[model samples]
Target: MHAITKTKPVPFLDLSAQYKSLEAEWLAAIRETGARGSFILGPNTQALEKEFAEYVGVKHAIAVANGTDSLFLSLRALGVGKGDEVVTTPFTFFASAETIDMAGATPVFADILPGSLCLDPASVRARITAKTKAIVTVHIFGYPTEMGEIMEIAKKHKLAVVEDCAQSFGALHNGKVVGSIGDTGSFSFYPTKVLGCYGDGGMVTTHSDAVDERIRRLRNHGAVKPFVHTEIGMNSRLDEVQAAVLRIKLRHIKDDIAGRQKVAQEYTQRLAGSPVKTPSLPKNGTHVFNLYTIRVPKRDAVRQALTDAQIGTSQCYPQGLHLQEVYKHLGYKPGSLPACEHATTETLSLPIYPGMPLDHIERVCEVLLEAVRG
Candidate 1:
């Protein structure tokens, strides 16, 4: 018999740690922005857009207020509206589908692949109808969705594709990055994201010139000139202060992503004998380790045991969107998405940051292994 030792509590994510390491750079950028008094879609914001576009390997990147707006604008610019259906995964944040509904389109739920926990190409093909206008393939937990397969499916059906890359900023699929593969790539720079800023910010990426033009106009009240409106739009511009910080962070993203990948490797090696399902390996470069999630028996019990041990944990998405109360009008039943429903019950995300300490990861695994044993 072994007596497992407990240590200090680990934070689910350490945003403060990351900030402290880059304090000098962050402060410098803030000072520069303040000195210029150029806020709100200024030079910093424009420069960030260019850097991000190049990072994602896309022709255009439009900075927006938040992730939801990034998706909403993508759908609107791609001509998704009333009487149209957008096929998307059921096991993810509600915002993925909510943005579709907000664009006045019907949200069609699709099952996920058991291994990837991402939208299944077969399920997507089954769900497409004559009225299906687009597909919003969400790269959940930073694993790039099966884009090549999905892209082929889209081409056969002539459907537009929006890569909801909220959690997959630097992740790549095949030889290409995520946002560049789809017609439009939507990103969220929420504080906890892999490339997050101090506050909320987002960007939309695309290869088409016309789509880029529409999003630029739609983000600022559909006006070609100041105080002159061509159509209806919203105020969803990324501010200069956030952009400045992002520019600094963007420079270090490659190394940060490498750190995350190393952490994931340690986790996979440590949890070798545990009777839990670890994340599947990604196809290209790596999964980027945005969230190092696993599936275990009695998941809720395991989570409780970890909590009692002063270790942080999280169930990324406890309930599928198709089964939520708000989506009742969609008329989906319990078995609507089997793979998605299965994930909702078992997925558990552990503490993972770019530079997460090895001792902390060991403690997390020890607690998790013990809980699953019982």
Candidate 2:
């Protein structure tokens, strides 16, 4: 085993560093919102929706409470409810499948592609049945899925497509932004994400005006006007404070993505020829490097070595959705989805964030390589 040397611990995500850089702007925006006292769906929220829609090249963008709410609302707007099944990858966060259940629909598990670690088109095809109504494709780790193939399958099956772009804010596939490609794209602004805010926030993007209008109503208790409920909808409105913070952050999203790309490049270069298998960026897509995950043999031992070395790491989804106790009622066993199961065992996410110093990247790589070899 390699000797473990203690050093100042690196964080899996340094939101503090990012906040420090934008503290002035963030505080200013927050104070401005406080001054206005327009806390819910205020000017900042409206502006952010417009700006984000323009950035994503979508016709509409509706700000919501959080990523999961974004997914649930999108599913509901698409009329996917009781007696419907949503095909999605099991190798993602619980919210991906949980949202389908929230919409009163069944979440059918599908295996991910070995290379991209995204919902495999073939696997999705096999999972579709008479009850399948939509496909929620998660852009895991900021790598775009094979959208062209997935879209084709969706069209042939007449299923709605929802792009879970929680980790891929600025990523592109085939010269088009991800959120704009699907029927509805759900995004998260959790502090750790690439285009995160100071607190929880999310957005739903769509090309159809009707869907956009429906989501607007659904996010606010299904009321077209105050106190006149048309349908039962949850209170999932994005707060003005978060919207204000997000607006400032959204202005620099492109630069943030570039910074993450640089860090990913440095990590890839430094880890070249090491035992670890680096993340693969798709040929026809742009990767924003939300998480610089690598597959290493003896993954747990390497993770422990890095921990001992004061270097942080994470296993994003160590257990796939199918393997989770919450989803046990879905009848998925350990070997139910081989690809997702294998990925869960081998994948480990290294510290990655926008504006990460090159020295930090080097230190992480040095420790990681030594740990992997040992």
Candidate 3:
């Protein structure tokens, strides 16, 4: 296909087209649920939990209000509270580290692996102390880290592993879904995720029966029964509306992921022989390509060029978590995590959503090449 229009800026995410495609079905689901008065954690939520668990190949899936709650509840259920430390990478979104803090645990920062940009196993190993209770491995940009190595390390240290699957809803490692490998898998459905809904939603997956039960109770005010409360807990239940929306999208997750893969492949092919370094995909599993990030020299200049050319780009993260103001009390200074700090200055995410036009990809590649080669 040829360019749709060279002057038209490439969007950062084409959620509009995605919404339009399923508008009719989505409206009907919403209407049906509302008419039935199934507002709270009702049949739809129950069914979504079952369906999502099967999709992840896990024994249990608990739906929650949002992704942050998923992580917080998982940590709490895993008994990670006061004076505990959770090891995680410094390169991910704030929610990754903040959830650990919310669970009353300290977040110990680790350097990122250069290529995958996920937690470096070596760094994670070095950061562990006697107080370390768990490891949160994030699959940044839908490209999984070496889960086998992470799991092995966790097993050796008797640490709980929570796979942050927010950006990697359908991604796999060694033919198994990402969430199935960890002690508890946390996911987000914030409309832009791989298997997103119209509004906020999240899920927690686990194979341990005890963990599952604890999460279920923790998500609903820590009650053993409806009224009899035990420990204090947050009201973090997923509503029926979001669940209704998620059910429809979950059915097409495989196709949606495949579309993202196609877009990423085309971008790689088109950017060949250029200065932009495309994403380094996982060798042993599928990369669903939630974000097609590239590292280039003069990253800011290139981003400005894309903007001037009417092409949109995003900064996955502009600063490392180690240097954030809130974590200053942890006593980390600049240059502490070299790899993550460098990435903060060089990475830019290009647009790559499901059903993105070939012509759009072409225009994006053209603009990117010019910006970097200039």
- Provide the clashing-pair count of each candidate structure: 0, 0, 0
Query: Residues 1-374, candidate 2, lDDT per residue (tens digit)?
Result: 23423475777788787788889998888788889989999999999999999999999999999999999999999999999999999988889999999899989999998888999999999998999999999999999999999999999999999999999888999999989999999999998898897788899999999999999998999999999989998899999989988888888888899999999998898888889899998999899888998898899999998888788898977898887888888898888899999998899999998877666777788878888877
Query: What is the lDDT for 76 in model 1?
Result: 98
TM-score of 2: 0.97
What's the true lDDT of residue 359 in model 1?
82
Candidate 3 residue-wise lDDT, 1-374, digit = tens: 58457689788898998788889989999899979987999999999999999999999999999999999999999999999999998899999999999989999999999899999999998998999999999999999879998999999999999999999988989999989999999999998899988789999999999999998888889898989888898799999989988998888888899999999999999887889899998899989998999999999999998898888889999999999999999999998999999999999999989999888899888888988888
- For every model shown, what is its TM-score relative to the native structure? 0.98, 0.97, 0.98
- Lowest-lDDT window of 10 residues in candidate 2? 1-10
lDDT of each model, Cα atoms only? 0.91, 0.91, 0.92
Cα lDDT of model 1 by residue, 118-221, tens digit: 89999999999999999999998889998889999999999999999998888888878888998999999998888899899999999999999999999999
- Report per-prediction Cα RMSD to one decimal: 1.7, 2.2, 1.0
Best of the two (1, 2) by TM-score: 1
Q: Residue 37 in model 1: shift from native, Å?
A: 1.2
Q: Which stretches of candidate 2 lie over 4 Å from their true place?
A: 1-6
Model 3 residue 262 lDDT score: 94
